[model samples]
Target chain A: MHCLWCDADMIPELSWKTIFWLSRPTYLCPPCAEQLTILKGKRCGKCSRESDEEVCPDCRWWAADAAWDDPLVRNYAVFSYNDAMKEMIAKWKYRGDYCLGKVFEGAYQTAFKQAFSFLSREAVAVPIPLSDERMHERGFNQAKMLADFLPLKTWDILTRNHSEKQSKKTRRQRVTAANPFQLTRTVKHPVILADDIYTTGSTLRHAAFVLKEHGCPAVYALTLIRG
Target chain B: MDDYELSRRYAGKLLLRHEILIDEPRFEHLLNAHYFTSETAIQTKWSHHECRRCGNQKPSLFGQIPCHHCGETHVYCRKCIEMGRVMACSLLYEWTSPDQPWPSHPNACTWEGELTTAQQKASDLIVRKIQGREKEILTWAVCGAGKTEILYPGISEALKLGMRVCIATPRADVVRELLPRLREAFSGVYIQGLYGGSLEKDGTAQLMIATTHQLLRFKQAFDVMIIDEVDAFPYTHDTSLPFAAARAKKETSTTIYLTATPRQEQQMRMARKKLPHVFIPRRFHGHPMPVPVFHMCYSLKKDLQKSQPPKAFFKWFHHRKTPGRQLLIFVPTINLAGNLTQKLAAILSNSTTMAVHASDHDREEKVQQFREKRFQILVTTTILERGVTFPSVDVAILDAGHTVFDEAALVQIAGRAGRSPSDPTGEVVFFHDGKTEAMREAVRSITRMNKRGGFH
Candidate 1:
């Protein structure tokens, strides 16, 4: 098999369990997987941002906001935004190499299972939506693709108004901008939002705020990368 | 904008929709006026695989996804994705209007040097082929036999008759190196040199110098197409490159292939007299090819594995006839090149020794510094085997029996020596532990070329 990102040949590892049970196919080679900077030893209790304190400053700002009532959102990211991950995401998202999303399938599923296990009840995976203009431009929602890796039911219960890309905005602008997400349908079950990146936790918080206002009991995020 | 001016920019060229970058209203008007033709960027053949833009049909290099625009499964070609996203849902545009006439140049070539008797014969053949619009011809000249100079006369003749000419090579380094020399030769004509990330995008030049990869953007664009180093890597290996070259030429155009070593099929065609051929056996300096001296070093791999310098290398270094000549050592792999560079640096106590490979970020800068004599020794892989010239360098191939060092590569590596006219004779050595058939053929080919050059 060839790696999805680098196109290098990947020799499947043969373990005792795989001899009879059959191993899950992998889309990334070992060297390409090694280049992904998986996040480790982080102190942020909420966002998985590598920090010395219990919560990162960005998450602290989201907690002190007065617009909503006791908004508690937790984000789980598989990898940090390293140069290699940045290039991989750029190729998959902007360059329209959609098959590269399969490279993250194994990692994303493993991270989701570990994060979603703590929920008291079953939680549905809700992908952060893109505006109609953005959807037509990109032709596919990247968040929706990552959400497809989850085994649970995926809910498309949110809609977003057209806004400038969060990547081009400053930290202050991102935290202070009006929320773009609106609930398409109400949900009573716990929610786990899936997105390609979680930067400053503003987008997820803004998304979570809308879900919570619609009488959702809890909201959390599972992201591919943490910038 | 003038309709002709806008359409002329895209005449005889294929461009993705995003690459057109024009006002949508104007583009639509041109389409309605029947000046532009549009088609799906990617075409699905009977096998359900094909990239219409680059002619890629490899199933493994294609991907399918649920496209939001079309609301169905869209297959995209990943082979040529670096150029642009050529998907089934996107569109490729071509201008169908008549081509704008190129201005003829009365005097194109300004080079004052004269070709040797052997080179003059090949140059005249090329001119006649271009004039008569023959299908193809091969100029099989030995390395350093004034291959670039022989093309000036034919290209000048073609440009004088208001014909579009393109000189495409397989390497970008050759394209960059040839552009300045071509400009100096044809000073009055408008010439454009194209490669990846090049600034010149408007392909309206009468004379063009481009890499074979750049030819993918052209469609029936050139009247005379010259392919230099026709047997080099990626061109001979990749099917898409040759397909692009064939697609870039008009139906009735002349193709001139330049190479030091033609593949077996090309040689067969020449022997059968199916393809016109010319042979220049000697260098422009009137010197025979440097024959390589083989030295058996049975423990070469063992020493390299132990991170120690081989004893045979020091013996060869001390017994060198010209110790002051620059040193070029070719290894089989990049890992070996790095290990040997450190080992040689420590042994000779020379800090100027460096290693270079295809992916090295400072590759271009290091080659430039080596040319300026900033470094005394360069350890490299087969990437430096062809299309590069170091005036006076003694060449050495460590591990010459490795699978990577085929017959063609060995000959090209030996050709690096004895290139300069002033210092034409440099030592070439193959330090091997075992002699393979490829090594034998490489040595035999060099001997045959020397004999054909009247060197006995």
Candidate 2:
């Protein structure tokens, strides 16, 4: 009945391919998809980020804390990509087993509660967006499942565009998908982007760029664990 | 053109394409039905037709067929023809078959051994310490101390309590080695082996043996975790993964680290504060620790520049790397390994020399060749230096002055010698043009291990 990510105007479309493959009828308007796909500013490897044109040639890579080109506010992870996480993701992403998402229903809530508890109490949890093609192949997006499981009043704010897989590309080729996201909606609170894992910080940075562009005060990320 | 030639050309050069356009009302009807059928419903009379003779198509349901040049039935349902079934459509349903699924757990150990006297003693101490103290525990003993066997009772206890146990290694080959051992140890227990390139299976195992990277897949599924190579590659340099391991385990779950060479931080933690740790000084071989030496190669460049083998280093290598002894030569780069391999192959006799690296296209074959003793001399990069050992083998670090020769790398490289009992005596040489800080650090670590393991 409702779109999971940037809760834009919801419309249900039924196709055998969509139902059997995706099992969900939600769709992302072009604008909502853009929010989850841009690169924003300079970022610290451990946390904060800033805008840069390239892997800052002079970036001091730190074992504990280094700077990345784009900065996302905070990373909020629903679960660590472990047995539990794998069990849940397999169900949601491939096996069409919706019950796995139920196990970690409270995880995202706990993260949201902690992330938004003191500062920017109005901070909202935004599930990392999946590309439409991926959502189709996977049958369901686990992030969306977590959002729905919590009924966390989430907004489908970011959209990953149709692009080559980051794995399929070299790091530089992967960077080409950087910061292309554009946002069209208005935000009422700070956004804390939620995902499964945090690796290079590229995904969160891109999503934060879009959120910041939409007048959101700040974007923070929290993952179950930082990969 | 001949028909056969034309067909061959099409098959080789062209991709087949198919396109279909469904009537709007019938498409919606099928969508509403939510199942595939031989024929979708239509709101009006059938008016569309296709000419097989001329490849002509029409959108209207009712039309005169052009290719047939006849007033015949023009509209036919493509779904119906494809299905060849009456009044039935294709239906989609989910299936839970492993095409294949990632295995939920690692195969348990088959190295069946009831706790030996020492194992039982270690087990008792470990259990008491685990329950009593939250500080570090180091099980320092000889090679046959049965470090893995000691963990068994504890692991079985955890499994009975419905807690998760995971073991991670730095190498996949090690996982392969341990899989059978684990299978026998945890008989009837559903254990998962998690590693990269592992075939997919459901994650329902109580015990999981995984590579360190696969730990990335977990989110607090384990009550406890045992890191087999705690001081091994990807673990020492990878700070994020230790945190990842912590996240994968339950908050109250204890983290047990196993290694022959615990890094300085681990030692500091054991001495300065309480941290959970364990060690096996000697291997299964009941022998003294292998002595490590540093032989500086003064004329290494002169030999290479002259397209020659470093003569002094070669002489030292030749004496040890006889027919009976095995040798592991670690070079700084693949290109260097190649150069030395060619030279060694030409000069060496009564011994075989083979080279391997991460990029070696025939890595598996080379590893097999080494195991089968097809090659007595194995020139490799740092990749194989850890997690693999050849008994009675001498270790030579050429270009040991390079920065890639880190303290950990050198120590690990030196560790490969004298691992098995049959050939407990091995040699380690560092043929460096100049000594770097890492070279000294590595030598210090080895001597420290030797002294701490005095007369083991």
Candidate 3:
């Protein structure tokens, strides 16, 4: 495998981690990852994990040097969620079918290829993991299934650590949790995070922070849609 | 073709809603199977076959034929003519002359896209039917196949032939689409898009595009009648329109039927006689038909009753809506639509949303808003199910188990999505508290239609 950070080839080493029935190569060798610099999104640098060129409100109020969380950027979506999308959503949501998800895979892959082709080779995708409680209720995180098609090492990186639905919590509560992403298992660095949807960037941004804190390289997020 | 002349020949054929009938006609399986108002004063063809040469031989097809000896045309047998029964002798000729720079210019037809093969074929058929002087034609094409374009060729043909043509539908959208096309195609020709508000009593116009209900006012103003959305809501259900179409058509003119699904009589006739019909089963963009999937929800209902949302259902729903998949939601009633709208709003708080129903007096505004995507989820009844096409919107019926959710409604609701060339296949989800036989039928029907890749 080619080392993602150093751009050098590494001797093949086997691992027990198989993301799916399609047993595929999983990671970058240690040397390349060690040399990597993790992403520290320029967030408000304090509370909100999403950031821009400026130090956002919360960080400014706290008088903190808001440079730590400064890598995240606003996401660009491929299509508007039109009436057509609403219909598809209603059908799948009401009837409880998963095969309909396949239609978006090709489109999402196409968008990803066109928009982020430069990173395709080194990008290891990690689907935003569902908490154990939600997992038991919904049986799956749709993003995980879609991520399977891409050449990425998958992981249940975020263990919910706390069981509250991330949706219910205000942006602040999610990040302050004792352990947002447990890293129960680790993966190849320079990963691309995957999820079905992105809103407020609270979940992905927090996960990105945890991964960077754990010595992972720059985290890039890819989602079907962003809001 | 004057109004009086058309009426003389077709007087006893069918009764319009206002046709001086004291009592509504009950359909009977007589020699000629058709509905007849008790008020109908039928003049049986058996009464007279007035042929100048062959007096009283057995009456041939449809009560009108040529004389055996003189080879001259004969409308009645020798008995009626001799007895002064005076059966009307009529010569039928479909005058089809393409109006070069048709008196009606192509102003209304600003579709802004290339015509599909179905539209072309329908137009050609319209021309041929006019030329052949045929009484009826069935244009069995699907909803988005663009029925308006099919009528374009017929518009000018009817005009140059000096025929007054009326294009009728059970719904307004059909008229709305056709009005512009007809306006464009027959530019110089005086045309009227008639519905309830716009009525041309002077009969000054050569063409009329109107709802079937509007046909009641005309005694026989049209020589060629094209009915759009033949199997749609009111046509088959309302006793008046079909009868009016039959009554309004001039003896020398033609009537063409355009529909994706024809009524029972049309189907039975086609099947029994194996009558050939022009079929355009796909939308103009040439995409495969949508495949409908059925999800059994009875087990999920029990789970919901246990005070838990159906995990499997949510899993499936979340996966499909995983962005970029358009959707349509159909509910049994306006109230249900409202309730579901609230639930969906709560569930998908991040997504834009809107709900629409028949009860909404501001329906036109809501529909226009939905088209613009001012609101993503347009909560609707069957009103917007079939005719309104929004690109890429997949469809689902919330309570698939309801008895009101019949085969017709299901097919219409399922047709709401994947209209754009960019995204061609629709996602159909039938969500039921308890799975019903109709749900299975709906799924199977859609699958079969799509298995042929929409060639049907």
Candidate 4:
């Protein structure tokens, strides 16, 4: 097989140790896979950033607000938003290389099972949806692709109103902008919101706000990367 | 917007429709006034699978994306997606206006250096062709024949006639090397150097030097387009670059193709009298091309695999350790280059040798250090085959029979030797387990050029 990014020939190596750990061979070469900065070590409870503080400054700001009855519970991200991650996301999302969604499939599956083990089997995985125009252009919603790899029952419970892409907005604008997500169906079970990347935590928070405004009792989030 | 501002900004420029929308505040009035015309970037009908722009019918290069604006599925060409997405939904805007009078200086040629007699003759022919209405001309010169100097007179003629000119090459490194020389030669003319990360994309210039990929951003922009290294990689193999080159020039503009080793197709065309070409077989210093000597070494890769340099290669290296001569060894791949450099450094002990390839981030610095004589030998891949000249350098090709080394590449590699006038003779050795047709063709081409002799 050839690497998707560099087109280098990748001969699969047979080793009992690797097979035992990884279950299956990796599609990416060693060097190309090394470029990804996998998130590890002590992380913030709210945003899953590499942090020593129990509650990071951004999470403290979100918690200090009394506007909402229940604050954001927790979030988990699998990778750090390094330059390589940024480029990979751009190629996969903006360039419409849908095949690249599989690069994160194995990692996302492993991370998802580990992050949300406390939730029951009936807890639904609702992917953050794209507007109809974005869905038409991109053909497939990237967040839905990530959620498809989760071990939970996935559902399309939320819909997005047409607005400027969150990627094109500044942090202050993103945090202060009006919520663009609306609940399309009533849900009583616990929920896990899935997105490709968590930037500033405003997008997931907005989705969580809409879900909480409805009848959902609890909400959690999982993302591919934390920017 | 003022008519002058609109014309100055958008005239002779090819822009994507999305670019226009992003800059809508500036182009809104002009677009609405019908001053700008739009053409499909990659023309295609729903029934046809072939792309009109690049003529690619391969399914892998074609993709379908739902168009948000038109509410239809649009098939786009993905082969030239690096330039931009060219789809049925996309439009390329060209400003339709009267040609603005270009500024020309009285004395555009400021170079004091003299050209050889053969170069002067070729320069005259090129100048005459450019001044006349010839559509295409080929300048086929031997390696180290001072091909860049021969174009000076022709370019100066175009500049004096108030015509916009462009000197485009396939590689960005070539563009970087040619820019300063062209700037020094034509000091009076405004020259803009363009590449991937270039910042000088705004201004209008009399002479524009750019890579072939940058030509995609231009539309009928040049009156004369001179493509250097016409047979180089990516340009020769990829069809989109040649298409971009053709699209960058005006309908009536002249094109000059400059290359050291013309491909077989070009040679056949010239032989049939279908293409006009000029040939220069000798270097400016009156030296014939260096013929490479092939040495048989049994399984060099196997020997290197055991951490042993082949006996023949080591013997040659030990014998050719002269005082001032630097050695350049070309390997097939980057991994082999690194291993060979390590083994050679251990064997030589007294001399400093380094390996450089495309992925080496410090490649420019390493090359600059080699030029400064800090390294005695440099092991590299084809990344250094052309656009680099080191005086008093002996070249050796390991595994010359490797599939990566084509006839054109081998010729360019051998041409690296004997470049300096002070030391007109340098050794070129090809150590291979078996000789391939490419090696034989390289030797034969050099012998043929040598027989033609220099124009005195």
Candidate 5:
């Protein structure tokens, strides 16, 4: 086997204790794995951003704003948006290396379990949808692939209108921009949004607000990176 | 688009359908006029599998997915995904238009530097091979023998004949270095340099300097193909690159390989007299290549674990010949390079010492800074083993017996020393815990080259 990111040959280390627990195999080598700064230490309760307080200031603003209707939205990210993660995401998302999605499968599974551990009822993974024009260009929906890694049922019931990418907009612009997501069907169960990244917590908030308006009980987000 | 511009840009090039879709009306007109050819980008019919773009046929490297365009399960090639995603539904574009004659330059070479006697002989042999339309010829020249200068005469000859020429290497750094030099040498000709992120894609230039990976976009494009550093990485390992190189040349094109350390198959072919060959063992400065002195550092690993070099390394550093020259340390892994860089920086109390590897984002800038003497000591991996030159730097290998330091790599790493004409003699040391066959073969090879260069 070879590393999905760097293409270096990965020699599977065999030990006599291999019969123990059946954990998912990692797709990264030691050095590449070390580059991933997983969300650890003190973090915001609402968002996974590293913070000393219970909630980050940005999440606090979203809670105080009347326009948001004080929606219940919490985001859990797997890794920090460091330089290494940024490059890896660029290669996977923009450069269209589809196999790189497999590199994060193990980590995504772990994060999915941790993020949904507090759920009292069953939740469906809802991938954030791309606009029609962008979908044709990008070929595969990254959020869909990420949602596939979760053991829970995935419901892609959200449709997005053609809007500028959140990455291209400023934080202020992203927060103030109208919601691009709309519920394609009435939601019966709690929703967990699956996305590749969480930047400024606006995209998740917009989706969560829409789901809350549609009578979905609770809304949470599971993202790969906390930018 | 103008007829002349279309003919010049796409006459002998391969482009993706999306690349040519910018002007749909003109493309449709050209298609109706029989001036364009289209084919499926990925071939997955029956048991046959191939990627028309990068020529990848590995079944394992292909992925099947629900394609948006085709609205079905489509196979896409993952081998050359960095360039672009080539799926089964995608189309590749090629111009079937009549070939336009390239402009001729009677006196193309503008380099004023003189080649040495051995270099002049090799240059003449290259010119003869190209003029005779030979299949291929190997130029086995020692390091610092002015391999690039030898190609000037041959390229000038080809340009005088109104033939397109290209110099492809495996390393992008070489393309960057060769672009300026080739432009300066052939000032009258239009030159294009292609790499991973290069913006210029006109492909209409008469002279091209590109990395081998960039050649996948070309089809029978050049009349003369000069592959530099033929034994370097990716070229030696990637099977698709050699296929790309062959497909990028004309039917009767001449390929001239330039390498300092030829691989085993090449050596065997040369021995069997089945391949035309030329050898230049002398450097441009007429100095013997630096021979490496093997020093045993038994406790090297223990010392490095504690973030320090062995005492013998310090002893050699304190009593050095030409201590003012820059130092280059080659380690087997990136971990060692980073650890040693920090330890050396602290011990020497100099902030200029740094480490670089293949994945370093600031690698190009660091190398440029090192060229300008901004860094006194640079630690690196095998990424700098070939296709780069530093004027006056002493070279050392920390783990010379490591499996990564093969014979060819050791020779190339040793060649980093004694490159400039002014600083002809540079020190080289191999600090190994134990000697390996690769180290012995490297020493023997350097000694044999020195003997051929008339050094005692």
Candidate 6:
């Protein structure tokens, strides 16, 4: 088999676990996989960035705002926003190489199970939605694709208004922009928000606020990468 | 976005339909003024979505990407995606400006150096063809025959006649090396180098040096096209590149194809008198090609797998490791390259060695250091097979019988040695468990070339 990224010959990782259980094979070569920085060590409790403080400066600003009753909840990320991850996302999202989504399948499943262990099994997982125009353009929502790997009950209850991409906005602009999310239905159980990338935590916080207003008791977020 | 800026940005240039979006302000004015006209980028119709650009018909390489701007499922060619995505919705754009006048000088070429007798003859014939009615000529010169120098007179004559010229090659490294030499040869000429991420893409120049992939953007834009390394990889294997090269030239433009090893089809065409051709069998330095010696060692791979180099191979390695003699060992795969580098490193503990392949992040730096005499040996795959020269370097092919070692590749690998005129000879050894046809063919070709002496 060839590596999905470099097209080099991929030697099978012949381990005892693979031979005994026949686990799903890896798509990337060892070096490419190693380039992915898994979130570990000391990190901010809210944004999952490598930080010495309990909350990063961005999260602290969110806490100091008088518009909300409480600060944003914690988030879990699988990787940091490195150059390699940026290229991989460009290939998958903009280039429309949909099959590359498999590169994160196994890792996302493992990270999901580890991060949400404290929550009950009945806690619903909802992917932040793409606007109708974006959904049609991209064919599939990336957040929904990541949610497919989770074993929990998944829902598409949140909808988004058409707005410019959050990536194109500055931190101050992102915080001051009007919230673009709306709930389609009220939920009583706890909900886990899923997204492909978490930046500034404004989008996730906005989605969490909409969910909480819709009667959801608690909201948490899981992202593939933190920028 | 005005007419002056638009003309300055895109005059005499070829661009894809999607590329216009890169500079929206300029494209908007061009669209408003109707200065932009487009043609179908891919030649074939959309029944099967076969890419005429890269000749890739693989379903995996053809993607149906959805675009909101058009609200349609766009089919794009992914094989040449690194260059840019060419989709069914995309069109190739050419500026509809009047032809720019070519620059002329009393003496277009500033090179004062003299060519060898054979090179001089080839240069005269190439110039006559360029100035006459011939559309194509093949210069089948052997390796290290100073092929690039032979084109100077012809290119100068073409420029003197007020024609636009473009010199294209398959590899970017060759273009990078050739650009400086060409600029130095013609001091006053406006020469622009075109490659990926090149900043001179918008310039209007009499001469353009670019990679073959860049030809896809042009539509009969050049009056003269010179294709170097015509038989090299991705050019010979992909049919679309040659098509693009042909399409980039005018109806009556002159094309000169230069190669050391023309394939059998090219040879047949030459034999049939269809392709006007010239041959230079000897090197510019008048030295013979180095013939390879084959040694049989049974089950060498098995021995190497057991962390032991075959006794005979080790003996030969030690014998050749005299001071100041650099070694290059070619292996079939990256795994073997790494394994051999480790074993050799353990054996020659006092010497410095490194393994490099296509995926190595430091490939360029390592090769540069090797040329600087910092590394004593380099273990590599066919990534360094051609377009790299190291004078007085001896080469060895481990597992030479492997299927990947074809005749053309083996010949190119052997050509790596004996390149420099100062040290025009070196040892070439093929260590294999069994003799293959490719081995015999490489030896036969070298010997045949050596027998034909340089033109007096």
For all candidates in order, the CA lDDT equals: 0.86, 0.57, 0.57, 0.82, 0.87, 0.80
List model 3 lDDT by residue over B146-243, tens digit each.
66667766766666665667887877665665666666665566667766444453233567777765564444446788877777765665455676
lDDT of 4 by residue, A1-227 (tens): 66655546777777887777865646577888988978989999888988999878988888878877544578899999987788778877887765566778888888887888888988999999999988866666888878878888889988998988888899899988998988888789898999988889988999998888887888899999988
- Best-fitting candidate, scored by TM-score: 5
How well does candidate 5 score on lDDT at residue A164? 84
TM-scores vs. true structure, each candidate: 0.88, 0.50, 0.49, 0.80, 0.95, 0.80
Task: Tell me how each candidate scores on DockQ against the true complex.
Answer: 0.58, 0.01, 0.00, 0.17, 0.60, 0.19
lDDT tens digits, residues B99-184, model 4?
67787766799998999988998899999999895899999888898999999999989888888899888887787788899999
Select the stronger candidate by lDDT from 5 and 6: 5
Candidate 3 lDDT over A103-166, as tens digits, reads 4655566666765677747567777777665554343467686677566566656665547765
Compare the candidates by lDDT and give the number of the best one. 5
Residue pairs in clash, model 5: none
Q: What is the TM-score of chain A in candidate 5?
A: 0.95
Alpha-carbon error at B427 in model 5, in Å? 0.4
Encode model 1's per-residue lDDT on B1-456: one tens digit a residue.
576576457777888877786888978887898787888888776767778778888777899889887779989888887776788888878888888876788789999999999999999999999999999999999989989999999999999888999999988888878898999999888889898767896777889988887888888888999999989977887888899899899899999999998899999999999989999999999999999889899898887677565678789988889988889999988778888898888878854799998767688898889988888999999889998888989999888988988888888899999999999999999988999998999999999999999998
Candidate 1 lDDT at B209 equals 89
Order candidates by lDDT, high to low.
Answer: 5, 1, 4, 6, 3, 2
CAPRI category for model 6: incorrect
Which clashing pairs does model 4 show? none
Task: Sort the predicted structures by DockQ, highest score first.
Answer: 5, 1, 6, 4, 2, 3
Q: Model 6 clash pairs?
A: none
| Residue A203 displacement in candidate 1 (angstroms) | 4.9
True contacts kept of 2: 0.00
Worst lDDT run of 10 residues, candidate 3 chain B, spans: B91-100
True contacts kept of each: 0.70, 0.00, 0.00, 0.03, 0.60, 0.07
